[model samples]
Target: MSQPPITPVTTPPPDKGGDDMATLAKGGRTNTLGFILRLLGGLPFLFVGFRLYGVDEMGRFAAAFVVIEIFALICALGEKRGLAQRLTEGIETDEDTPANLVFDAMLVSLVVSGLACLLLITFPAIIFPNGTGSDFDMWMIAAIPAFALTEILLAAQAYRYDIATTVRARAVVEPWVKSIGITAFFFIPALAGGGIALAFLAAIYAALLTALYSFLRTYGLPKAWRPRPRYLSKMTSRALPLIGADVIERGTRLLDVFLLGQFTSAGTVGIYWFAKEVVSLPQKLKTSFEPILAPVITKNLKTGNMDAIASQVRQVGFWIIALQAGIALTLAIPGEAVMGLGGPEIVGGTGALAILLAAEVIASMAVVSESVLVYIARKRNLAISVGVITLQGTLSVGFILLVQHWGYPEGFQAAGAAAALFVALGVASLVKSLVLKTLLKAPVSNWRWPLVWAAAPAVIVGFIFTEFTPEWVEIIIGGPAIFAAYFWVIWKYGFDEADKVLFRKNVAPIDSDLNASN
Candidate 1:
């Protein structure tokens, strides 16, 4: 079929200062809500998996889940970010409608997911090299389209700044459905073993259906549903850089598992996976900003407003670092107890959990920096990711081998892998930050001394409680007390004007007086 005429996208006019801040604040609120829902809905599944099925079954499920997620990312073709960029450019220039963008992304995702399903069906061994069983293998293949479509729909809604749709489908509906389904299936003798995996598959389809209904309600149906081959070609080409960056990024998360599978048992992989998943919660706070930041950055880029772009980056970067630092301290201080919740067998991953959490904190700068660079210097960003992941892979394998050869305990083997991850990520973050600084000719000063000050007290309190008290008291009481102190310190001393703005409040008058006196 003939392609529609391409509309040339133009630069959008610069937004006023207050307007920009207001946009960010709104995005932050919605993203935070989504984060909370995800935590509430998702945590139960983790507990259920570990509590009911135990480590080995959960490990097999994790392996299958990882493979399915990787394929979904591939089929998404980077539209999670690309769609936002495209829509921002198109909307600003009035060259395309929301319907068309959604339609195009949906079409591309369907095609790519179909092909991925075929590939998995053709070579089941690729996903389940260790044999995930026939039922799980089938469930994994069946879930591909649903997983891929949910990604596209969420991206589409994010383009409209309707993050609540994602929160509803992903955080609320999907996880809850899976959790309930798994719990229900536990009583059935025949379905008990692979029930969690099946529940997960059912949940994906449910979420996809919810997303579709939400999309239609919010944006209505596509006006002209034309399947233009050239449109698909253009989108694929545009998304290739993003695809590479995403694959490399996700590879960092899964590389540990893949390598561990070779060296360690399924139970070990399950332990590592749980630790990684827990540490990743804070990372989500950073990602939540992307859907909002993309449109703002793209708009500024169109206007050739490098100053605005840098300011946004610095502000958002600092916000993320400050929050993440506090979260890392909170989680890592009671790491052992937190892991213990997953059962006695998984508590051995405490060291790995602490190391991984630290890695996320160190890597926050690079994560925010890459958000900007991906739009400005796509190829360079991709190259940096490739280099980082290659380094990570090498170190991970070497560390595993070294630990095994040195006769370290099996538990420490995971710690060694995690340490390798921390080192690679820390170095990569430093390099990426420096490169971004050079490009922007602006310093990314997200770190403040007060963040350290705030974290110190929280960590001290958390450590005391975790060490001296029972696990329940440590997690329930200590966590809240530590976080309370952290937030109070941050409020009294660490918060800047931008942070105050998020709360719709100005700096306190006493602080202003203190500043004036100084």
Candidate 2:
């Protein structure tokens, strides 16, 4: 008996543009649930780390992790978005399978990541600009390979429209493991100093394993797979713009932490990092669409279906903005209460929390637009990303120095960084959307008046809770009340017939034959 020939992941027929919407909705619904679970899982780590390890130690951990994550992104080489194009083009040999292409990416990632790990391990200071707690801190560099590989594997799964695997690995497995591992490691007196690093290592590797298992199951073993040096070199060269774009876009978020660690005290960095984590919940909503959107856009581009592509950009853009706006309102309105959840010492970051949440909401268009731009105009997109990050760096430093000159505290400096991010992202969103609109020759703006209507009521609801109720009540009651008010308005007034598909329980299934055959 012989094994079956390998094929790309199953997707709905390209002709039914409606089916594409259905696929997008399914992914969005699944990841929306993941965001909730991730919120639950992530909060524990923040509480435990802030309460037990204290701000200085966690700040050190955040500083180091930022460096490692950036390096990991570089090693992954932008496969998260780029791989969908590779798969869609089927540019490799007819005998070569999707799994083979993935393996080639994995091989390249491993080589680059291995080199990164060695470099970081040697310098160590690059990872920990603010000195290390223990020699075990160097071991955190091990996360680079795992993190990079997990990115590629998860991208492979997303190509197949299997976002549940992503939800499981990222939302369910990674955070919970770190939460549990951090709590567990803290109990051992000797390990307590390095608990955050150890827990992060554990989390990254666990997610890697989860993603690996899913990749093998879905893509199967690559047949006749061999490394082709010339081919891989071409692939890597082509990926340079995407790699730059991914790093620069991600760098905008991490640069503040990196710069803050250089200028501010560890405690200040800790406060800002906590606010960033809280804002990340809404940030994840935009990403929920990225993996799904990539393959959809690639397919549409294949047929020169500019209308379908534009429609998707609008549809997904609205979905992300609507959800992010609701989350931003709920979180930002009671910013102090949310930051207070970390610890009383962390409450000073309330302004930063609000600003970061607003940044996530405003950055929605840039993220969505980039999803298309990466495939169509990657170099131009990369150039714009570079400009945005440069602006963010300039503004962050200037604002921080201005606050210091004005005799404000370090917490105000942290808020200054968040403010810079808000402005830079607003610039990125405006420029990127305009560029995308020009190329697509269609309207791609996600702004709708209902968003204003929804947010206005939610803000009032949140104001009443914050003004009249206890801090605990404001958090416990106000959060839900604000969300209810925001989404209720969005549901009644914002959602049109097509938009409602995101919430529909029984979307017509993809063809069963496609499922079984794949």
Candidate 3:
């Protein structure tokens, strides 16, 4: 049978540059709020899990989590950014809507996730390479489907410029559930051993439910939707580059843990994983711009508005670098105090924590550049991603082995892994940003002298507290002082009226145009 001719959905008219900035700012503001909430909510779980569960158990959990998240990202098929491009390009028929398309991605993800669960179930050793703390550890793979589906649903909402939904699900519901669940489950004698893993499962499902509610509210049910295997195969094939990019990009973060689980002890992995988690808070600032950047960039691409894409990328890149730099300095300067909060045992990871925080700051440019490159230069972007993760993996292993050969402690090994990440990410940022600038035919560097100006006072303030004051004072009073000093300089020198848009609360709401047809 012959298929009907496919027609592209007519694109919406481009909004003024100001409106685009407003949309990006709105997303930044919402996710920035989410970042704070995530920090507050996530810290409790870290504290309780380390102090209550102990480093060895948490280390095992961290190893398993690395596997779970990697597989989950694979199952998601890169819809985190790809879905926005798909929706922006439009569906094939009148009967098929964005809801139907989302369902397509979800259905595929579920099938893959089920297979993944079965594979892990057949060989539980893959997840617990060292050993399991409790019998219930095997069930953690069940969260894979929920985690994958949540990514799709959240990406769908982001297509409508609905970042608040992501904020609510990821920042508010997810972390709090895990934190509370970990604490609650700890008290039950039967569940205490596996409470951390159980809490993680609960959090994944909670966030999925939260995302589904908002998705249905916005997109409703699919209208006359039906499965198409041929179309699905095509969709999956088209997403290969994106999938590889997403997996490899995330792999760099987890590869260190996986390698360490083999080369070092479980407790060492726990300390290193704690540092990764702490640095992830600032890392979220870059990703907060990604979902929203996709739709805006795709819309501009459809119209040949390369300049608009370049401008948006620069704007978002600066915002991320500035915010991440300040946060990194504040945390890394008082690194020992922050790491000690998890427990004194965790204080050994202070060096790793400082290096990982710096890595996040440097990676911001690569992150923002990839947002544009994924659309205009998918293969090239994927190539760069592949290259960097390979470099990161090699360096991580080499560093760990060298440190071991030198008779260094496990803490030094962990810091070695972090230093590897720092080098790889700095290389990635420089190369990726250059590629993006070349492709866009415009200057795309995010660096500004004001960043140095902003950091100088922050460094001075942070050094004062670290040298003169107590740990509590450094964390409580000095952290804020560092932030204030950095941002004050940023506001006075770095920000123009456009950059100030991120601070404004009264911008017009960014709404969906998904239901439009032309």
For residues 250-344, could you state the per-residue lDDT of candidate 3 as single tens digits? 78778888888878899999999899889888988989888777888787787787777777878888889999999999899999999998788
Q: List the residue pairs that clash in candidate 2.
A: none
The lDDT values for all models are: 0.77, 0.89, 0.87
Q: What tens-digit string does per-residue lDDT give for candidate 1 at 282-345?
A: 7777776877777777766766766666777777777777777777777788888889888999
| Sort by TM-score, top down from the best | 2, 3, 1
Which whole-number lDDT from 0 to 100 does residue 456 have in model 2?
A: 91
Error of 2 at 480 (Å): 0.3
Give me the displacement of residue 372 in model 1, in angstroms: 0.9
lDDT of 2 by residue, 1-518 (tens): 66545445554356456777788888989988898899899889999999988999889999998999899999999999999888766643354678889999999999999999889878877878888877678889999999999999999999888899999999999999999999999899998778898998999999999998888778888888899999999999999998998899899989999999888788889999999998888899988988888888887887788877888888889999999999999999988888888888898999999889889999999999999999899889999999999999999999988998998987899999999999999999999999999999988899999999998999899989999999999988999999999999999999887888899868773442112212
User: What C-alpha lDDT does candidate 2 achieve relative to the native structure?
Assistant: 0.89
Of models 1 and 2, which has the larger TM-score? 2
Query: What TM-score does candidate 3 reach?
Result: 0.94
Candidate 2 lowest-lDDT run of ten: 509-518
Whole-model lDDT for model 3 versus the true structure? 0.87
For model 3 the local lDDT of residue 195 reads 96
Top candidate by lDDT = 2
